[model samples]
Target: MVGSFSDIGATSTDFCNFRRDLLAYISGADAQMVVEDMYKNKEMEPDFYFDFDLNEDRELCRFFWADTISRKNYVCFGDVMSFDATYSTNRYKLIFVPFTGVDNHKQSITFGAGLIAREDVESYEWLLKNFKTAMGYTPRCVITDQDPALKVAIPNIMPETRHRFCMWHIMEKVGDKVGNALAQNMEFRKALNNAVWDETLSVTTFELKWAKVMQEYNLVQHRWFDQMYKARASWIPAYFQDIFMGGLLKTTSRSESENSYFGKFTNHHNSLVEFIMQYNRAIGEQRYHQKQLDAKGESSFPETKTPLAIERQAAAMYTKNIFYDFQEEIWEGNFTCKITCKTNDDGGYKYTVHETGGNIFENEGVEEIPGCYIVPRWTKSACAQPMYNVVWKACSNTQGGNELRTIANQLWNEFYNCMGLANGCPTEMDIMLSTMQELKGRLQSARQQTRASTTPQSVIESILNATAPAEIQIKPPSVAKNKGSGKRLKSNKEKATEKGKKKVRTCATCDRPGHDSRNCPERKALPDE
Candidate 1:
């Protein structure tokens, strides 16, 4: 019976009975022998400790610890830690994780353990203290979502760390301030992202880009971006190289991984101790596997490199077709043609060319291709290259050894026709003069119309001055009317005759509208005046 009670299937009651029976059985045994047996069994059992504790020296355990510690230190010392707090199933508890450094190539390293706390300060303090304690030093940088508690606690604890607000969080706030479409636009979003990263750009550049984005999105002044930019110096890291704490930082993904690990053990166990034991066992196995992998190679695999030759080949293919077509145009007289210039008043000429019996065919009223243009939108001063396509196309044909002398003469004539002599018709100064005259005429007409009509400002001011002193309108006191009684006015004689009618009065104490003050309890209780 005692043996059965001590078996693996033993209940709490059975355990108690087994202990009692064990005492009875051992009471007469050799005490020294029993003590030796117990000691031996205890030694045989594996040593168990918390995975996060400093004493966890297993190779896999060391790798996890080193990786996590490295990432946390990097984020703290270099990047911003964007933190947010959420509740667990347990009441009066909070969990905080820093969201940042997520990328496609590799997972972020700054992710650390989830912490529990009763209040904001406690939670933030716990996170900072644990980080410092684990890394054996303070971090130099921090980034987080704007939580008041974290904002307060960070300066108090890690004062040296550069604190930054998360751009994602800022964007969310902007969406709330503006509309969803503005926040989601690819071009606008790209511009906003670039604005945040552009170190060489002035603060005005940032403002201009922000305003453009807002205007494009049709957003009103929500002050979200303005407020964020006000604290920009504090939120963004000073250097891109320093942002990752030398590649040690990760975002809040570690806490998520921990949660998932915890879930596996928690769902199958009812007892807290049992759950903990199972969790540790699973962790031990994982650590063992990780250690084996680490010893053989690095924690992560190396990425493959692409060849430069392939890229060159691709670029060559894109530009190949243009060369053959240019040679054919040069063989025909159409390559070199004279362009005649029509002078405008603004000292500029509109250039046009008419071919005289050339093999080159001209299509009338042809719509311009999307990307191809005769003249580019803007010209660069440093560029020796011609802005007009006409020069390049003619030159390409000439280089192919098929240019007629007559066609070149015609081209030269067209160039001179557009550019008028110093005092003559096709000068740039004439074009400017005409444009100015047109503008002046328009302005004079606008002024005449403005003088004829009353301005809105004057009208508003006149109305303001003419208005009477406003008075609050109060409705006359209402009397409940009897449905059967027709609208009637009591004459002065009738009012005097009805004066003997019992008057209903409201009690001051109870606020009942029928009783007199004399019957009021509160009124009666007061001293008689």
Candidate 2:
């Protein structure tokens, strides 16, 4: 027989009893009812807006929240957002949807939150619409996992917004989707990585590398590759690297982390009231941390790398965290990089930036591949002189070939322009042009000096490899629009091939040939054993 609560606390069965009590409380309570009460309470508070949906049976289907602070943060830092519906919280199995943004301290801040009963398009649409309604503005860019429903809903709701698929999520799936043979192939992996991650490569360069990789691996017919290629613009950074994303998030990783952070306070076993209370506590702590960062940002000044006006300006303008990042760029731009004219005549100069730090590729414990592969020098062509506004082509590929292509473009104005060309010097326009001409002259002199010694046998080989075309010109495809037809009708052979190809599901847990890990029978015994 169990005694009073005080006596139970001293016993060995305390934890078990506590868990049992929590379970009992959760089972007895109505989650929807508790949430409704919370809604009513928050309604009384200033600037706290929440909405919910119910099914025909009056069951809670969805819930959304945006408090006073959340709305304020959204207005300031709402330009970029990372929305994810991956986490399932509460015993009710509600899909936790969070619209997260970056704050001043570079911390993940929740702009709004939603809970949905289903992962369908309708549920997502409702959630997104509610978020839009509450915030009164659409985010410029939205990053999320590659969910079909979300892919549909985002554009429907916020048509102007750039919807980016999380590169991290796409890259994470690569190892599992590609077989061991391809995964083990070092050259293939490198090519694939370059194809996916190298934003520095122009579209032409990417196409070249991609074709080479796919042909070598015979992966042109692969379903995953086909789907990913078709959806390249959604996930690939090379497609839209120019857009500003508030540096908040490039992936849904922050949202995932926020989910885990919220998990520390509440559990699935928690009662509705308990869950709400814990959620408030978690949110309170998060906001408090933000406030602390705000105070720190406002009160302090960061030390500059050099006594440049731009560096000082950045230090004064941006918050501490962002200023540090700017400072890093300042230092890197000034010391580690150099500009040389690749080609220059009358029709503007083509300058290539030479950087000491190139792309570094390594396989950690994979002995089959080399320990390290370092691309010591990578170059980007800058079209036109600095005075006339420089347009830099994609730099050489990144060291760690991940899918996010970072294109560093500096516009002609303020410190940004200064750092790129003059190393933070406020020079007159004529002087800058003269400096460019002198640099071009120097490059021509250097190239002439190094041409004979540097022109390897490979250049001669490449020249020999180019076969002169015979007097034959293939007829181009018909450009005239066929009446009553916008679609290209596929032949029977293509249809048959499509029908023959069946998509396979691999078990993540057991690594089995068939079946998903979620439905794997081996999961139960496999974990313990």
Which candidate tops lDDT? 2
How do the predictions measure up, each by TM-score? Answer: 0.36, 0.59
> What lDDT does candidate 1 reach at residue 202?
66
**TM-score, candidate number 2:** 0.59
Candidate 2: where are CA atoms >4 Å away? 1-29, 86-88, 337-529
Error of 2 at 351 (Å): 14
Across 1-529, the per-residue lDDT of candidate 1 in tens digits comes to: 3246454454788666743543333222222222233333233322110122111221111101122323322333323333444333121122324333321112233334342323367556755665544444454456555667878888887877766555555554544454556656677668766766565556566667667865765543546665765676654333333444322232333334445554555442122122223434545565465345333332332221333332332222222222123224433424465555444535644545556665333333222222343112111110133222211111122321134656777878965665544246556767856875799789979977976796544443342222111331211111112211224576454566588585756677787876766787777788979
lDDT scores in order = 0.42, 0.66
Alpha-carbon runs more than 4 Å astray in model 1 = 1-86, 89-114, 180-190, 197-208, 211-220, 234-242, 245-529
> Compared with the true structure, what per-residue lDDT tens digits does model 2 show for residues 176-252?
67765766778877778878887676667777777788788888898998888888878776777666666643478
Q: Which candidate leads the pack in TM-score?
A: 2
